[model samples]
Target: MLTEAEKAATLWIQTGFTDRTVIQAAVAEPLLAGQSVVGVAPTGSGKTLAYGIPALSRLVPGAGLQLVIIVPAQELAIQIRDVLTPLAKTLGLGFQGLIGSANRERQVKKLREKPEAVVATLGRFVDLLEERKVVLEEVKTLIVDEFDSFEPDALRDILSFRRGGLPKQANLGLFSATDNPTIVSEFQAAWPDLQVINETSTDNSRGVVHHLLLDRQQAGKIQVLENLAREKHQRVFVFFNHKHVLQKVASELRFKHVPASMLVTDGRQVQRAEALQDFRSGRVPLLLTTDVAARGLDVADVTAVVNFELPDTLTTYIHRTGRTGRQGANGTVYNLGDDHDLRDLRKLVGDRVALETEPGEKKAYRKSAAHSAGADETRGVERQTGAGHRPGKRLTSAEEEAASAKKRKKKKQRWRNKKNVGKHW
Candidate 1:
């Protein structure tokens, strides 16, 4: 049932991926048939190729702008352009990237040439559209990658063109790793016949990933990172929750002569590009970044991902860890935090990924009654801390309680003595 174009496109990409991912299988035929689809697949499940192949199949060389792929970040725009450029070339189609922090004059010059496809950041694309440098009337397919991450106003402005909207026949494709009901509903209302596919439930593309917990205080974070950098064959992505913290960590790592690069979403485009390039080429083993900057990155063979700080939400954790273990490759996720941070992380991820102790770690996270039943089934040994406990000794619940009571009594007595000495009994 494949169209001639679709058949040719599929054959061309087969050499890259051994098997079709769930998202690819579910979306290829429908998209090629010009059906609007909203695909929700796990991160690293090959969403780019799933959408790219079909989009290319429908392109006509020298046919003006027929496809517009909108992404959240500038880096992501460039990444997608790099990914699909060769495929587009094989089909005699022209593809170019339009992003912020790059040369607009150059992009406009390329636009003048009538490229068939464009991967663009929303803001930059809108600027061009407003300036009348690009037109959407001929655009047959519009793909919004990481749809949930886009701001509604910017997206609405682009979709509801000032001159007019996209051609009525233009089909849409929205893709993301996580789902936002509000965004989905808004999009669904715009296209009543939108085929919503939830492949996360059935998508099993993840590889053997080990989620490790490294217990370290805030002060020891730099030392831990320095040690991780020396590990052989480790292409690590160090994630941070805040910009200030990421900056501080990056400064410290650089001072320590650790060959780690930092990537910030708001930084200079050339610097960000260079950092990613160095990391990808293995000239550097560590790349420090925030979730926003690294969202939807498709870097290969990321041996490990270290959380210098705990992620803010479960979705963030999933995206961060999903960077590794891509395409059935073995990877590790190291979480560097204190006991309190570890507890918060355990609660955030819940029973989704088991948090195991680092090898040779004598003390590991102890499961409390508040943890889910599945979380208690950890392979690591339980950790205990209280007064009168030996370095490597285990204590029963009752014994631990007794020790706590004794410590509280001693502390109360000391406080009373200090108050009496001050004549405040």
Candidate 2:
């Protein structure tokens, strides 16, 4: 008999996932045997198909909520739903996305319809559990995408698990582009039989060129960006560490008449969804977003990733760059740096990132930038190349604790005042 991955890939026929990667193949072995799995793989290496195909092959027809997929963000939930829904249809399965920003009454109506699979943000899923609109006892498998960022304590509110009625031997699939030791250790301690898989790659950054531009107090960052956008005329994802900065950069891009928008994680689901749609459809070619877009965002044909400011963590740096050069496509990554960023840059990307005075044109120094006379309007001057090595050490102590604590507090607050959490009616 053909294995589950083989069977599904064969049926996929260049539809969902034509070929499986190393981690995808490795993850299949255990899922075929109905075992729990946790994995770490490079971003954009087909991580979705790595888990989706196996989970789909195991979908239970007419089984209420047989599969529960928990994601870290509403955008990711919708994106995954979009990717898996078509594949599910190819196999005659039904799935629903239950996110925070959508109508609950409609979702309750869909609940009446009993979708075999559900993609949900952890908070919204807990909300449904509290309202008794869904039963987790029917869930045979729980897949946590972006598990690294998913709060481990969110599992404490799961109706079935909390009530000691969790579906018998329920399987788990925890996956992410980066690994969180705290999250993984907790999961392993809870499920001693779980299988673990991690892939560390230096070449995943291959086919990508890295460039560094020095900004003295970010004086010329926006102008440098505008020049690139006008010359390249392609989609670019610019990352800012702060929400306010993201808004400011996005506004500057728009004022400069660059087709641009911003992505805010905590923003309303409807609004954020629309912005992403506009960017994806090429209605806008530039998106200014925070680190939330650093991982699990699968925007197609991004020509470059601009780090308006580099993130503090190396794993985040890797994921930010991972946004481009995806699936073997060539891309350029622009990193803005300064005197303070030099030591950190050397530690993260090392010699692979080439330093430059600026890209395209070097004009007479001015308070406001203007294209140099005799400069190529194409602005295709210097092209330098570089590659990255490995993930940085564990994040700062405060950051680690804060992320976990915030997740727990959010989960707790969502359920504390809600009645019927322990009732079925």
Candidate 3:
């Protein structure tokens, strides 16, 4: 009694996957039937394949641009393309990606071949549409990944695309980890009969995440990172509040011979790809980045997430911590800051996050980090307690106090800079 699309999905699952996840199973039939759907699932819950498999199953080979998937970031677009390539191949479908940084001429050339599917970022996709390089008349399904992350202007563009570019009978799919009511209302207004599938209530896809606090002075954070890097099996994502701190920490770690990668929002695309590849392939164990660059990052082996400093908002906190403990993989979240920062983090997350506070579980890691300072010295880099100078010997109490005062001043400046960012300094 299986439909063709269901039978195709069964083949895909039998090929490699063990079984369909809840979100995947729920949305497959509807999506395959060409019905519009909004799927909300937890992070790393295989939303890609949930929508991707059904979409591909419904595609006709050699069709010109039948499926258009819009993502918020270039990296995510590439990730999806890479993930679905094998599946697309199995279905005899040609898939391609349109990202802002990739060569425009090359993309246009590829478009002439009549690819069946295209994954893209909004900016580049819009540009192609404006240039008449892409035709949506034949498009059957349009998917927007991470719908909640789109800005207002981008959302307007998406609405315009749905109205003007796409065919009247085309299906729309929106997927995100969290749903904002206002955005959902806007979509519902646009498509009054849109179907919503919120799996968060019964979603058991996320693994256990140990939220532990590492209450250390700013100077000692680098030493702790060094300690973590010594662990060969740990792949950590270190989040920072500012790009400057990320740059400094990355530089210091590299100077100490730690194989760490740095990813920035405005960096060159090739370098960004290289950095991500290095981390993904286990060539480097640490990836230090800010929120913008790390958004929607889906790496399976990320065993730990380190908050170099707490994020500015709760949504940001959720996105950062969600990087770990993904897809039923047990992971750890280490919040690295002073006591004041720890209190602020608790206030920011409220009852949503459970921080480990037991003496044995929490204090054990702190004790280990403190004792590892001596171990770091054997690598020929002295323990750094603050920015600027590296003294040959350890600092006295007065020096430590002065360093703490300077650190406080720097934090205030950072806040001011953040508030005044994008304005004339």
Q: Model 2: which ten-residue window has the lowest total lDDT? A: 416-425
- Clash totals for all candidate models: 0, 1, 1
lDDT of 1 by residue, 260-309 (tens): 99999989998999999999999999999998898888888888888998
Q: Which has the better TM-score: candidate 2, or candidate 3?
A: 3
lDDT of 1 at 109: 91
The collision pairs in model 2 are 352-386
lDDT (Cα, 0-100) at 186 in candidate 1: 73
Give the TM-score (vs. native) of candidate 1.
0.82
TM-scores, each model vs. reference: 0.82, 0.78, 0.82
Model 2 lDDT tens row, 13-54: 646455567787788768766798887887777777778777
lDDT of 1 at 127: 88
Question: Candidate 3, TM-score vs. the true structure?
Answer: 0.82
Best by TM-score: 1
Candidate 3 all-Cα RMSD: 9.7
- Estimate the Cα RMSD of every predicted model relative to the unseen true structure: 9.9, 14.9, 9.7
How much lDDT does each candidate structure score? 0.76, 0.67, 0.76
